[model samples]
Target: MSSTTLVIGGTGKTGRKVVQQLRALGEPVRIGSRRNSPPFDWENPATWPAALAGIDRLYVSFQPDLAVPGAAKAISDLTYLAVAGGVRKVVLLSGKGEQEAERCERIVADSGIPYTILRASWFSQNFSESFLMEPILSGTVALPKPEAPIPYVDTGDIAEVAVQSLLDDRHDGRIYELTGPRQLTFPEVVEEIAAATRRYIRYVPVPLEEYVEGLRNHDLPPDYVWLIGYLFGEVLGKPGNEDVSGDIERVLGRPARDFSDYVRETADSGIWNRVPSSS
Candidate 1:
């Protein structure tokens, strides 16, 4: 019997794409999620063994983020469990320039199981598929730093690299810093979307504290608020995260998708023009 390849967070951005590519190749895959046959919840340990059972390979995409508190320990424990469970290979999706994310990378590296690390920049899909979507829909993209340019990588490229890493041992022990072809600040990103969708989306600069208060007004949890604050304030607000990387091209043997192309494609999908139904 072929060992099942377990994709943790399988329904999430990159995980879902990874699962799709793997299934397309006819690989035996078990999606590890709260809704799976043996549901896998990161906060729950008993769910670990059942999820790891009969799995030969694993793709780890930690939810919230690896920078959150206790994420390193969780990753370490989970990697240990995977090794003990006879899993041979592991591919970890990590964040670039985050110390905590690097710590989690070290955990996977030292796990004694062959592994690949994809330290990715911010995802481009945040504008369409995540928190920024609402602000985009509202026609105003507000953030703490409008000038900080991020080399936002595409989740699709990340997924492609992830699938290759899981199947090919050549990627083992390799740490690929995946980034987009260029950097774009929040304002520039909004401009691209506006041009692509032919809408008058504006970029507004909001203080970090005000952003947190706004999140609270929406009744978001404390941890979620902290995560968002950390991502924007500590990660994007800081310097040294805006460099373009050639690793995507090196690994996939193709140039990383440009932000303009992303905007154009996403715009063509009509997601940007979607109207919120009146409740």
Candidate 2:
């Protein structure tokens, strides 16, 4: 029953939704992002203590990705500070296929706080707001994941679950693996977008090498390239991950939104209708 909720990565896809939901429920929400008040920068550990000062509960999301290097150690360090600062509850966002992400989850469980783990599938927003957005706006999306079937979870559902977990003590210690109700391959997902937007969207299968080179050609950092490569090449295609999960329904008592629904919704948002940002 913590009223003051701290959401890290609070400006990103799922975090933004979580913040909106918490505020809608009349909870006092604090955003923990590089630009948020009491700014929290993951690379700068000095800012961690200030962000945790008044927080009794936390929705912790690491930046870029949880699968990246040093994530576990960073989580471990942050959890120590949270515990020391009187944090009693935590909801950690985790990647479904990432062992590294799980390492961070374990650290939170060991932090002696009431905790919930939301092991999320690839996000539908990956195409609309994340790395895939640019490629889509350019009319061609290329990646290493051509045949890799994914159950892309909606950010809305992830936020709903996160808000519930932060507010409900009964949900503590639960590990929920949330996915969409159906699975889709990259090309198939692209086709769904094409159908939704009434436009042609092509999906190309590229080797990891070529994808990294593409990232470099855009003057992006290698860290971004490496993270993207790992997700597309390592996490996207797999048997255990391709199936849908009912955790979203079980937690929220409603069916998860489909990829087609997400595409249609985002298509109208004008996010896809305009030129994608180069940032």
Candidate 3:
């Protein structure tokens, strides 16, 4: 309880929730971000030790994602430094279906530091807070994998498990593959949102190549385009990823938030209905 925890990607979806919950509990939390007073940049290793200083526990949520190329090495290097910096425990957030993410998980496990791994499914917040938000607001949720149902876990569930892992040694050396209670396909997700918001929303299923080209037309960077293609084509396209785990209930003693609940709550927040201002 006396430990100061460092949250990498502190401003991110689950990272922000973790920081908020920890601070509300009067737990000492350090925001590890490139824009922080002492910036922590993933591409720059020099900023790492400064952020890890005086941090007893670490919550690592890698930016972009652990599935991207070079992520395993980065996690490896950071875990090595974290152990050397006297960090006692680490809770790493990882992608469930990504082989690259699993490789990064192995790096953290082999670092000689006590670790908890949350290999999580896709996030429910992606519809409200991430790249998918723009498409949803545009009334068309277009992408590949219209048939694949993803058990999108709530970011809050992920954060709660992370906090418990950071504080409890009992979770050490455990890998929790977290997900919601059910799976929802792209069209089903849109239907939920449309019902909740009373708006007309379309789920358009396009070819992977077309989706990539659309992203390019929108001027999304090439790296981002590749990441999207990898996620939709490789990760989501996998059949076994439609799994639901009891890890959220196991770790937090409560059921994970369903996608319908997420849609309803997010609708009340007006995020899906917000009108973009003229630039």
- Give a tens-digit lDDT track for model 2, residues 132-185: 788888888887768778888999999999998988898999999999999898
Clashing pairs in model 2? Answer: none
Model 3: worst 10 consecutive residues (lDDT sum) = 270-279
Residue-wise C-alpha lDDT for candidate 1, range 153-265, written one tens digit per residue: 99999999999999999999999999999998889999889989999899999998998899989889788998888888778846677788899999899999888888989
The 0-to-1 C-alpha lDDT of every candidate, in the order given, reads 0.89, 0.87, 0.89
Candidate 3 root-mean-square deviation in Å? 1.4
TM-score of 1: 0.96
Clash-forming residue pairs, model 3: none
* Per-candidate clash tally: 0, 0, 0
Error of 2 at 91 (Å): 0.4
* Superposed Cα deviation of residue 209, candidate 2 (Å): 2.5
On lDDT, the stronger of 2 and 3 is 3
Off by over 4 Å in 2: 275-279
Worst 10 residues of 2 by lDDT: 270-279
Better of 1 and 2 by lDDT: 1
Backbone clash pairs for candidate 1 read none
